[model samples]
Target chain A: MSDTFNFFEYYTHISQEDILLSYKGPLTDVLLSEFSRDIRAKLQEDRRTGKKVFAIFMEMAQNVLYYSKEINHFGNNDKVGTLVILNTETHYKIVTGNLVFKSSIPLLIEKCEIVNSLDRDALREYKRKLRSAPSEHESKGAGIGLVQAALTSDNPLEVKIKELQGDYAFFVLGVSVEK
Target chain B: MENLEIQGESGVYFIPTVKLRADTGVCEISGESYLEDTSEFYNAITNWLEQYIREIKKPLTFNFRLTYFNTSSSRSILDVLRVLKKFQEQGGKLTVNWYYPEDDESIAEEAEDYMKDTGLAINMFSFEPEE
Candidate 1:
């Protein structure tokens, strides 16, 4: 049996939400800067919160760009991911999802839990300590991006990990900035 | 020695504007820094600072007016600060001024963190963005 995808139904569902922008494709530095410009424009109404939202967006998008398991045969052979921004009356939400190795899920969840459990001062101290340590190039920023995202949003990370076929899993990270 | 100057670009990736002068002894790095090659980008600047301290030994001033920088850039920044701290330790005159948007406390706080990390005195200056 085959399940046919319905574009119209998906569009209807998306339009019903408060999504400001959404994209599912290769996460390249070029595309990241383009999305950065778009996010800056969309968040122009509030300058202060816009900075926080923009900072969080960069961190989360770059996370997908670096760690996603799915590689796209596009410019620079970049990774693929999904990014969405939603606007609410009081906050702006940034969400990113990408495929990763299922083996990394437990570590990712542990990292999120540690970040969520920290207070503002603790998070700052953690980031400082990480920054001082020598980073391995393979770690791709050494998880400081996640800590930076938490610090900028001043909110706990909303993470969801779903096991996929074979050794792959989908990792979704969401952060909110009060406007 | 020849000076180093790079025009920062914000296209595919952000490159912080850099101007390191051996003649005037005034170096300035302004604009956002979220480069694809963070280490390669900042290493050249750090090397230049080291050379200036070795050869010039004059009163050097560094002005940082970055509005945004990522975590990797933050590490590179600490490297730069370390260089300044070294110069200060060796009896070389140095002044490091960090300028940020008057409304952005995070940038100011980041400079403060650099100060704490490097044990270098970084003067903080906040400026208003023209509307």
Candidate 2:
């Protein structure tokens, strides 16, 4: 076949990966609620893993909704991002990607490193410290979403940063829970 | 002062049910909370607690029955716990109890972390997960 876009090829790739859900574009509250309902229903058979998967998904999705560099002005000015869920033999992986300011890469990397280095107790302690710290006006959230995600998944977070044109870069975060 | 009571809803966002009684000095926050305006919602509850502690000064029982709460809501919960800790420090009589699903250990662990963070004792109880 010629070097062209093939719909079946894309479909086959997705099927092979066992992608349960995938979404691109704006991340809004409405979308999150709907996705959460669907996920709860889809994973009803395994409530414990289902809860962990949902928790990690919410934390990561909210991270994108709040911090993505790209914003869609369709109505509520929601942030644009990508979210995908993959079911592997051993784990359920929730991955999210969004554009962020290039300057934030270092801090983001440090945060991820800190989260991945700690054990469960230590992660909880770290989350406590961050939560109790004096709140900055600009950042109302405790900035401990990643820490929470790590604790819930009981797996080290996987992070990848790609340099993009201008002042933005793509940030991808993956969290996995044992199935 | 008038009591504060907000009915929880699970529509676009999960709003935790809240009730702060002025007469009995019994306050409850139950249900799931994952709101976009997390801070705003918790701030009012925090303020109400402060007011109750200042004026009522009765023996207070704080009940937490949250099934799920996001990180932002966790921060707000800590804020509320801190207010209670302060009240206890000032010689105000108070008891804090937290309930979670028996299947979910994270919620119990979360309460433990809160206890460690605020230096306040929290009584943890686990119940059957709702059907």
Candidate 3:
């Protein structure tokens, strides 16, 4: 096979997914700002739903920015990932995929379960506990981000993990906010 | 100690406005906070606060009017609250007021949650018409 890649297949994939906004690369600051503005503009039809959609979009994008294992050109440990937003008739769905270190998978799985299982009040309590708990690492999130996503979402998080290579896996999470 | 004033940047990353005045001893951080380097940006504010707590021993009033802050920035926000709580516990006069839109129940709830974590009574001021 050759080193050259195909772009036509990728376009079809995106079209099939009904992607509104799609980005595949390092989650840089510039990309975030532009995408958020466009997303806000696109979601302006309903203010209430728009707020939830925007919030969820930001949360998911940040997750990819914080956790993805893909490195950048400058040798900085920059998290790289893919983000896609889909606007359907009944809801707004955000899908994010990133490379994850094997060791963190258990914690990530547990967190998803914790958020998915809680009601609004209970999730609020969970968020409080997370904030008060001694933060494990400087690079780690407080876990409240996912809780925030859950609060804005109408459905539980749909998370899938696929083995990629040694000590790395592709982690995908889907968050849906109803319109 | 001198005052520190930072203009909130709405572009690139949602930067919050920060003003710490020695003359009035009022520190306010308003607007959204979503910085590229979260810790680096917040440490500057905390360092200033630490110096103020050490040298300029005076009553401090903190006003937080943030509409949005990412999780990373939220950690820094928690750090600030914890510092204030400690200052109060050590007999330092401290007042924290959080102003948010009345309709934004989420922000109010977050402030309440902050109150719980810090064990400090945070005064919440609301604006905007409620639905």
Candidate 4:
């Protein structure tokens, strides 16, 4: 089978969703800032929703930045991931996808389940516990970013994991922020 | 050590304004911080705080008025806060205040979360945004 992804098909779907922006490739601090500023510019009317959308965007964006299996060997060496933001009549959707090692999938799924299961107060408590706990010296994060993303999102975590060739899998997370 | 002052810059990535004054023991990190290198930029600030606390031996006040910061930068912020909290536990006079626009509760929630983590009182200040 051809390994080509159909850009036309993907963009057609994007256009239908009224996506404000969609990007595929490496996610750097610079690119993240650009997306952030764009979100602010587009959603200037609602400061609260803008902030929440931005917050959720940042957290989810970082997950792609840190966890993606495919590395960007170019400017600002880092992993590459796909990121998309949609503006609908009632809500904003921020979606990010990246390749991850197969070994990490179970943990990611478990974390998502827990976040999806909790209420706002329990989520806050979970965040507190994670934040206060002593961290391993080399731990990427306490996964507080995910917690913050879930809290900022309008709905529970929406995740899809697909197995890729070898020891890698594609992970996509979609978060919604209602206006 | 002499005071450290860095003019904040905004672009694809923002560097927050950093001013550390040893004489009056006042340090302020304001504006936005989403850096090309989070650790390299923040280590200088944390190192200065460490030195000042050890040698200067004066009351320190930190005023943070950051409008935006990315999650990676937030880690460095927590590192700085942890240093301050440690100093406070060791009988160092320390005061931390975080300022945000009254309209944005996102920053406020983040500040409160920082306080919750460090077990330190972070005074909140609200201000009007310029048109």
Candidate 5:
């Protein structure tokens, strides 16, 4: 519940997976630039392999920028969150953690369930349907962004919710794009 | 009037390339778009498109070949599509073509979503990276 929890503690728990690059900072354009450079390098190493790693990375990074609750003075006015990328022997995993009010959990869970239940083709059709629907409450439930993330990812989307203090929850989403 | 073009850079946000031809009303928006100020970056394009619809009133052709764009940019893209929809309703001839990497199904889906959202007909094309 306390905002004083050391971020270093969280960093220590990252799995032993090979990290081509690790960045912890205010999510700003500057940080994104640096992060993109590192990711581009790693992606280039496998560029000839026909992997769409950068597109997946861009989605994860945007989620962190828009959903993270921890704010610093340096970054853009987007939301605050922590984002990490792990490169295993055969795939790349992108993890992002952000805070959302407890009230929104049900809606979030429903959206995820609906997205997960569909195959790639169905998901694409659903995404198109949502996109075409009139803007409800100013584009909050469009769900197009998350659907796009799922379609880009080869593995099923993984979502974990951890209860924080009174009305806040930390939501962690993991997506894997195969090489 | 004149074609609009913007270059891409690092750290400064993705500047989408815009090519609008007054003679033919053909506009193409390509490249990556993740701007620090989404409204500021896209305002001009939206306004230009609006003016073209009001003044030029020619058959409009739009081509989208963007590889990456953030959620905020997505909103602006919707705005562009909405304008085209309005123009079409007013008896303006409009055609939209969306190009995506063959492997990037997400982009293709995004284009489809826009078409569905606006009820506009769009031709979708897939391009594979050259070997």
Candidate 6:
């Protein structure tokens, strides 16, 4: 066995690891079923390793379904986004990136940072306090889902943002669970 | 009063099916809940429970068999549990049973969190999926 690896060949192989799943159609009831089917397959593979991976997968998938803003095929009313699950040698990484309004990025990043800093006990307490509070906005972060995802994953969440034209930005979150 | 039934969706919101009985005092909220408008969808259920606690003034049993719910829905669920807790505190009979999947530890922990938050006795049931 040689220690040196071919860069181009390795890059091609690594790119194949990227699993892309996108939805852009009518906002009908079947959309849930379709998304569930794809997620279930990924989850089954995660289940073979442990429960934590499955939990992380569920949280990320739900976020994409709930928050993605780029509409395709369907009218503007439909929810849209891209979700990718990649498998490395030692960990399963979930990368979910979606189009969100530029104004929402700051708040979203703030919440992610807050959740990433908290320990499990503090996160649980935070969830309790938010639950007790009154609802303000409909789907904006109440700091529950991201917190749950952080608690479930072994490492802190990795987030990146890119400017995508006027009044819109691409938000990407990468979470990994040990296999 | 008529029963409340809303369809569940994946993208927008999860609609939880609600069945409330004034006569027997049995209330059941089952199915998944990940809704677009969490408060708007659950406000009716909370209002109905309030009316039941005030007018009917009978013993109540709440059964929750939700398979999956997002974070927003979970907050609304806490609201529902709080209403039940309030009724129990006021000398009203109450019981809550939360059924969860056997493989899902998060759900069990969530039920425990609710129990701690409300200071109410809740029966936790572990269920195995049917083959």
* Top model number, lDDT: 2
Task: Quote model 6's TM-score for chain B.
Answer: 0.90
Model 4 whole-model lDDT (C-alpha atoms): 0.84
Q: Can you list the residue pairs that collide in candidate 2?
A: none
Model 4 Cα lDDT, one tens digit per residue, B1-131:
78989999888778899999999999999888878788899999999998988898799999999887766677788889999998999899999999997887767887888888889999999987664
Return the clash pairs for model 4, or none. Answer: none
What is candidate 5's lDDT per residue for A75-122, written digit by digit as tens? Answer: 345556777787888878787788877888898789888989999878
lDDT of 6: 0.73
Ranking by DockQ: 2, 1, 3, 4, 6, 5
Model 6 chain B weakest lDDT span, ten residues long: B3-12
Error of 6 at B67 (Å): 2.1
Between candidates 1 and 6, the one scoring higher on DockQ is 1
Task: Write the residue-wise lDDT of candidate 4 on A35-154 in tens digits.
Answer: 888988888898878878887887788778777888988866788999989888989899999998899889889988998899987887787676665554535563777877887774
Question: Candidate 3 has what TM-score?
Answer: 0.85
Summarize candidate 3's per-residue lDDT along A1-179 as a digit string, tens digits.
57566788867877874578888877777888899888878767666677677778888888788778887776555668989888787777889999998888999999899899988889888877776676767445647778888876757899999987799999999998777
Q: Which tens-of-lDDT digit does each residue in B21-103 have in candidate 3?
A: 98899999988898888889888888888888888869999999887787678778988988888778878899999998765
CAPRI level of candidate 6: acceptable
- Give the better candidate number (3 or 5) by DockQ: 3
lDDT of 5 by residue, B25-123 (tens): 888988788787777778888888888888899999999988778656877788888888899999999999999877666678788778767889989
Runs of candidate 1 exceeding 4 Å displacement: A1-4, A73-76
Considering TM-score, where higher is better, how would the candidates rank from best to worst?
1, 2, 4, 3, 5, 6
Tens-place lDDT per residue, model 2, B81-100, is 99999999999998999999
- RMSD (Cα, Å) for all candidates, in order, is 1.7, 2.1, 3.5, 2.9, 4.3, 6.0
Badly placed stretches (over 4 Å) of model 4 are A1-12, A71-78, A132-139
What interface-residue Cα RMSD does candidate 3 give after superposition? Answer: 1.7
Q: CA shift at B72, candidate 1, in angstroms?
A: 1.3
DockQ (C-alpha) of model 3?
A: 0.49
- Model 2 bad stretches (over 4 Å): A1-3, A15-17, A136-142
Q: What is the TM-score of chain B in candidate 4?
A: 0.96
Candidate 1, residues B1-131, lDDT tens digits: the string is: 88999999878888889999999999999989999889999999999999999999999999999988988899999999999999999998999999999878989989878877888888999988543
